[model samples]
Target: MTLPTPPRLTLTPEELRALTTLYTTDGAWTVEEGRRHCDRLDVLLAAGVLMPVQTLLGMMYQLSPQGRLQVFGTKDLAHSLRRQQDRAYLRLCLQHYGWTRTTPHTTRHLTNYLGGRQLIEVMTDGGPALVGGQMTSGGYRGLAIKEIGERLRSPALHDRFQVILFTPRPSMGQTAAAPFANFLTLIPLVPAGEPDIHYGVPTRAQYVPPPPPWDTDFEWDTPHITASMAVRLRRDDSPLPRSSVAILCEPRSARIARFKADLTMDLAIADTQLRRHYGLSAEDIEGVPFVDAVLRPMHANTSLEVQTAVYLRSATLAYRNDAALMHLVGVGEMRRHLNVVYPSQWTVSTAGRHRIEEPDALWHRGAFDVAVEYDTGEYKLHHVLRKLDGFASRGLRGPVWGVPSARRAAFLQGEVGSRLMEPPLVTQWWLPETPFMV
Candidate 1:
């Protein structure tokens, strides 16, 4: 079944006058003034001259300048203001006042109304167009609408608008072959532009990356524990999804002195847990006088400072990988690598194992291994750190490493003059031959 169309909301003449007055006034109104305005509105509503109180209030809220409408009513009514349906209704009312309405599915009507030079110019004129909460900054909207206007100005571009509307099946995952049951003409105004482009409407769908391998190592489990603790300590409340974690481990002989100082003081686990697991009490974990004396310094002194540098090196590599992934996927994947790698006796061997290699390699061999056998997580972490160190130590003077980009290749070839050629023109409109619409 199709979704129900929202009702059209309008205000009576008296209610409109009140709204106008409110807009014109400054500072909080006295109780008497508020009561008088409410009484006038109530009288009109009683006589069927004004819309329902809720509808009227919703419209008023939308019309008010940002942060100004919250002072209008009782606490009970204020609570309902947060609802999305209320916000949508308010938007509908504003749209009715500002622009004439057509059937929701009428792409032709919308295009005819919005496509005209006069209307496009006006919309792009940096005027207030009621978008939900606060009025959008005209400059921002103008830039967007201007791009649209530029596209529509060209007949070649005008033909490119491909509007499609469909009730996407909830069960079907994103694929190359899913057919949309309904379609509408979409006008490509801005077209696709860098850094990224978003067209059509937004939806609330979770992006699930391809499934993990059957024998995926659980090394990710440790990073998750550490990351959760870090997030808790920082009091970060962001709702962004978590993807992968990078762990940087620095293994040193346990006899090294000043090793604890190199680690983050706020351990992921409490001293009690550390003591319970390692046979060292809280005092011993904290390096109390007696306990500190018992743990002998190594013949070769290794400072916490040295350990931290190694960990930072590893973390930086992890960051590079993250940046690369984000470049490929519009969304940034979670970087779960540990900021500090701790010394541990744990070891794993993969003398003859096979597994998928690089992230990109997955698409090619379906699976491939860089080496015959290695501790996948530890090896990757160490390799990335070592590569970063090499780049830094060599002053990046010679051949650059990692997945080389066109930009990098140009930079390295001493073709600086040729690389500074004029920027390519961005086509804002679509040609008639193209399959997709804006």
Candidate 2:
């Protein structure tokens, strides 16, 4: 009978690290030279992956030919050294850039020895780089580190850059506004006086981005897991983490939905957002329990969070179009930032039987309290009329319907204008002209 092909063996991270350190020596390394070497060298030595030689200069360790064969499956130390060196250089490159591409020159070198795993590409300011060659597992697995496709709310899950790398140890300088940072922006890395000295990354970055939002991780949907993997995610058959209902029900996500100029809040990260971040298969955007619960809440209070999300999403669209708030004020960069008071902050109704109507939001535009409604276009005609009638009772001005687009705005205008004699004070998709302009 023919023997099955022997499973190709590969080096563990520790072993690989030790071998790379040893490979740097011209012959043998004195113990003194091994001071900053990997601590796993002893493990490698015990395994006969390296042997000590008694030389005129005292004792030194050298990788034995037998050790080379055992460790690398090849006796050619030079060849294996080159591979390790390439892996290190490439890994360091990926670390520094967060994402980078190989040039045609480097690609020519890597293409010949190429082997691969799940293909990943890095997009830099330079361009997308297809890192060709043996992409070993461990430090480089899962998603390719890049900043795009990331959700940027407060309690951010990713910084501007995502890199699979060893934590860089760099000395920090004084935390003050330094005018020198302008010149630093043109320079990318450091020159530590080594191989790529002026080429490789420095101990400190010349240009540092502003501090990112607070970082956070997700509570994945791994349910019914045994003690084995349950502990892996800090769970013991607990129902809360995977329960989208529980997640969306929390106040944090809703609070985040209502935002300002540089909107910062946390995530009740939707299923689609999470999947897109990891490059998982595209699925429905309205995540389970999240959308259903948001759309079909048991009560008004239950739907508050969903409304808050819509409120923000619509606000963002308006902000982009420079939307007018109740035709009183504009919302965008060149214009003034809106100081919004959300529904939860509404004062209780004092009039007998006056069902305390709360519009989606009220934009305090210095001289005006412009009432705003974030319409999802799902409201029934009666529901829409009821909401409008409630706003009409407020008696200061007509309400602003923050619809999805100009088409929706026009449609809403036609619907409401035909019924109400006053019509909407302004039916506009773009930001409002100040009430003074009105």
Candidate 3:
């Protein structure tokens, strides 16, 4: 939100203080005394008999704190006496008409004796003449007389009086000023008993706005992390296992060595038995097609390190999909750095087909292709078996073997990992150096 610029003022704090003191102290002088003081100061020097100083003093008294005149020095006595006389005249008129004057001024005693019984008749009968003649061309005093007439005539008003007085009007001038009757006669001089009128004026603060309510539940300091994170990280030690093994059964990293070794050992044993039975030398069977078939199992035990790297990259991508680091190193960059290598022999036969019996198990079978497809129909049964075993070792369930009923049932019900390395309808070849299994 934009803020307003602070206000600039020419007056210094000291000067403002002096001005305030002068206004408050000298402002309480009688109207005539205030006028004379203005005349001497060469201020408020208007041409009329009633000086503007009187107007200024009257306004200050009504508007300032406490709404009462302040005490000026001895030189201000004459002006004070003149103002007292005017107030006295008004009080005399009020008391003479049998209208209550709460505090009659000292100067009003003589007029009270003369006009005491005649004021009501004079005011009632001469309402129009008093209002129009006195109010139309008269100054501040004239307006006061007019207002008194209006209040007396108003049917809605109760506790009516002949006159009401306001020491200093709220605003000055013909248009802005409150009507004398309204300020002086209409508003009641409410007794001190009512809490609102202890000082004979409205109790509301003039210009201040009401303050905002307190916010008891507001917090200045909130916890940084969310509750879910707190719960997930609440362990006393390491949250994950010390070491993990991930397998990628692609052509580059397949466990072919162990399979080949096992197959070679089995083949050698079978060949020895066969040769012994048939009385044939090992060299005689060297170029047989069965020998090459036996060697196929060796490809099963490939490089575990390369496969682990690929799986680690895939896991990272899956886990840190929304991390800032992932964005910093773009997804394409990450894929290049950690490529997923699957066995070349394991082709996706039915790339987009859904299984009729196990439709809901598609994700578990690795059948749902996110970026690459994995299916059994287009791949050899032996290749699928190897891939399934590799995936199972790495905490994943492999795809279902889609073959004829008997063959598929045999494949599913067989020792899944062992059969993948078992020779088929051909004698297996051998490799000596590689381990039989990982």
Q: Ranking under TM-score, best-scoring first?
A: 2, 1, 3
- Please provide the root mean square deviation of candidate 3 (C-alpha atoms, Å): 44.1
> Candidate 1 on 1-438: residue-level lDDT in tens?
122422323555665666545433311222333446655644433333222211111122222211122233211211112132223332332333353323444324334534432221112112312122111110112233334434443432344332221111222122211221121211212111111111332111112123355524432322212445435433553222121111111111231121243223211222212221122223222222110000001111111000000111111111111112122111001011112232231111211122233221111112321111111112243454443344335333211121112333333234322221122111110011111100
* Pairs of colliding residues, candidate 1: 162-186, 162-437, 163-184, 163-185, 163-186, 188-438, 245-336, 245-337, 246-336, 246-337
Q: What TM-score would you give candidate 2 relative to the actual structure?
A: 0.21
Each model's C-alpha lDDT?
Answer: 0.23, 0.33, 0.25
Of 1 and 3, the candidate ranking higher by TM-score: 1
lDDT value, residue 392 of candidate 1:
37
Judged by lDDT, which candidate is best?
Answer: 2
| Whole-model lDDT, model 1 | 0.23
| Model 2 bad stretches (over 4 Å) | 1-356, 366-368, 418-438
**148-175 per-residue lDDT for model 3 (tens digits):** 4454444313433233332222222334
